[model samples]
Target: MADKIFRNGEIVDGSGKARFKADLAVEGDTIVAIGDLKDMQAPEIIDISGKVICPGFIDMHSHTDMSIAYIPEADSLLHQGITTAVTGHCGESPVPVTNHNRSYFRNPDEIKDIDLPWERLETMGGFLGFLEEIGTSLNITPIVGQGAIRSAVVGFSAERPTEDQMEAMQQLVEQAMDEGAIGISTGLIYPPGSYASTEELIEVTKPVGRRGGIYFSHIRDEGDKLIEATKEEIEIGRKTGAAIHHSHFKAAGRDNWEKAEPALRLIDQAVAEGLQMTSDMYPYTAGATGLVALLPEWAQEGGLGDIVKRLSDKATRLKMVASMKTEGFFSIAEWDKVLIAGSSNPAYSGKYISELAETSGKTPYDWIFDALLETRGQIGMILFMMSEENVKMQFNRPYMMVGTDASGMLFEGPFAQGAHPRAMGTFPRFLGKYVRDEKVLPLEEAIHRISGLPAWKLNFKDRGLIRRGYKADLVVFDPATILDKADFINPFQKPVGIDYVLVNGQTVVKFNVHTHARPGVITTH
Candidate 1:
């Protein structure tokens, strides 16, 4: 007898094959049987007669590490049918915290409500242990963050690491891999990680290659330097032999919209050359990041205190503004396209830079500087820069997978304030808008991209497919009615038509309502 059985559902299997009617049984945390199981007996039976059952969606790239400690329920993620999340993305992780980098490990303003167990999270092993102790709502696959490693050893300095420092960094990477991290990640556009030269990156990633771990990167540039950045990533893979996965691959800015095709061609060429290369993307034209990204790189160095000092200096502020103008900050014509997504002050939430600047009777740069200073550089902004045509083009690629690039959050409390719609709607929006409405991809192929492709890339042994011995992580949804309701203005709304979500054979979501079950485990490579 099985614990529960899903009957009369069309199974997609996350294999890119045609769907077929099947009855699936789950016992404990694993799928016990699949196929014609008319005689199967279970204490609980779900009649999913009109729904499609598929492997739970895997988020290929995410920053859930930053918020999982606070939002362990992961309501937004579970509601969207995400079963496993590959976190520590874009060069940020909570592990390997050292005295030198302790203050910078996580933003204090973001976690003012709860106390984190810092001592239990200083290492990858300890972090994983802590997660298990707390229990999460979805399986978490953590990766070592290059930025955090650099911060721990190099302390956010742009100066090249000493030979001893470089060795220390390598040791940290090795330690993380040994502690069950799947691979290493770099946020090349962020500080500390961005300060590393290409040679430094190749050197640091050597241990990952030796361990057969992947090297995931949010490349150095996404605008005017798109092609060059892509080439740099390839060079790192070529030199280090580490499998490469680009995070939230995009060509930002109006001038670089067409660069998406060429940049992807580089990936194709690299693949042809035998360098393992893949990419993930969210189904959105706009992207969200810290407002401080608008500042010049030099101005972003050091810690928050140093950055505040620089912002306080009028001469330095003027120089920064000039540099941003010259480099095309935000890469859009009007500041209105840049909306305030998150901030310490709620008044700024949901307002655009243009509106705030106009109301304050100040220049856009001045308003930004004032906002950053007032919030102490803790503001988040959503930039509307990418082209929808390019987004659809990327979605049609065979090598591309889907990622939310947003953290899990509930629809209430501090977590919901100014959250990106992608946090709650990426999967449904991709399935609803792209696959169902526009026909960008067949449902079978699209399901594979979100499930099987990521699972294979991450080398998951049994998950990501609805196989008889695999972990019982599954979702059942109505193909015709599934649609994302979250939008830029009202990002708190949940999607509709997802009927059930099971994590580890336990129902975490039923009919779009959270069951508050924390059955997720720390999945390691």
Candidate 2:
């Protein structure tokens, strides 16, 4: 006897093997049986004859830490069959917030209409407890953020840490690991994390390596110096035994697009030498981040507050503009490629900088500076600089996995406005466009990359496969009709063709609609 059963479906098993027709039964939260279970009796049975059944997707990289807190239902993620999300990516976890680092936490203005009840979570355990109290629609695998740890110890100063400060940082990493963080992550391009030296990173991550935790990094540079950045990342793994996972691995900017092949070879060579390494990417040419990323590192040195004052000072503003002009960072030549994804000003949302510059009667640089001021450095943009060919090249790699690098957003209210389409449509796009349409890889291979591969990378033994005794997290979808409706303009549209999604045997999504079930839990190594 079982609580539920999915009968007569093509089961992929998340193993990258051939699919087979079978019936699977779920008792409580585990898959009790998976085979010819025609004789199995259950309180509820689903007939999925023309559908494909596979383990629920595990998003290898995400930034849903606060977004999940804002909307625990996680409607967008669940609808796409994403049952487990590896959040706290790009070195921006929400936990371990201290008085010194409170400002580093997500501000109230980010999620405009929604009120986050708990603002100052000072520890990993505390943050997990708060999540449990609120309940979630899908499980979360949190990674301690390098930015949060550094900010907690030394504010946002871009200086070498003293001996005592370095020791404090190591203790923080150990404390977070003890509190159930699966690994540690760093966004080397962002402030705080970017300010950290390579030596400092190796020291802080040594504890993670000792505990067999992974090291996930958004490498320092992705443009002209992409290969150099790859070498730096590989050096971290060579020096430390921690498993390395590159986040949104890419070669941005058209001028540096040729670097993609060599950059990947560096990773492949590391793997050939027996270094534990892998990477993840979204099926898109554009990458999203704050507009401040376009500025020189020196302009963003102190922190956001200091940056605002710098922008206001006439002499400093001239210096910043002069630097940008000289460096050709986001110049008019690339202005059209920069799309305004999100901002406090709705008028600018979804419009290109080139278009906005024309309407404002200003240079692209001045228009961008004014836009940053209007939004107070919170403006988000999608830089469409990567090549489609390069993106497909990365997708063909065996070690590559999938991740949205976007937040869990809803389809209505403030959260719905100006969201990246990846947040709503990544998995579906992978299956529909890349697999079914483009015929890049077989369906089974894509499932393994999204499911078993990510689970294996995290060292989770029980959840990524649909074998007997494993957690009953599964998805059933129409292989012929699966489609990602989200586009650049309508970024909040929910995907279609996913029939059902379950977490811990509880139906979270059915008939392509969310059932509002909150059966998700926290997973730890």
lDDT, residue 3, candidate 2: 99
lDDT of each: 0.90, 0.87
Q: For model 2, what is the error of residue 362's alpha carbon versus the real structure, in angstroms, after optimal superposition? A: 1.3
Ten residues in a row with the worst lDDT in model 2? 324-333
The best candidate by lDDT is 1
Q: Which numbered prediction scores highest in TM-score against the true structure?
A: 1
Q: What TM-score do all the candidates reach, one by one?
A: 0.98, 0.97
Model 1 stretches astray by more than 4 angstroms: 106-108, 331-333
- Evaluated against the true structure, the overall lDDT of model 1 is 0.90
> Model 1, range 1-525, lDDT digits (tens) per residue?
799999999999998999999999999999999988889889999899989999999999878985897789989899999999999988898878998798876567755677887678899999888788999999999999999999999998899999999999999999999998989999987898899999999999999999888999899988899999999999999898899998999998888898999999999999999988999999998899999988888888997888999989999989998788766454443597899998989899899999999999999999998999999988999989889999999987788999999888888975678778999999999999999999999999999999998999989999999898999999999999898999988999999999999999999999989999999998885
Look at candidate 2 and tell me the lDDT of residue 378: 75
* Candidate 1 lDDT score at position 111: 56
Our model 2 lands, by Cα RMSD against the true structure, at 1.6
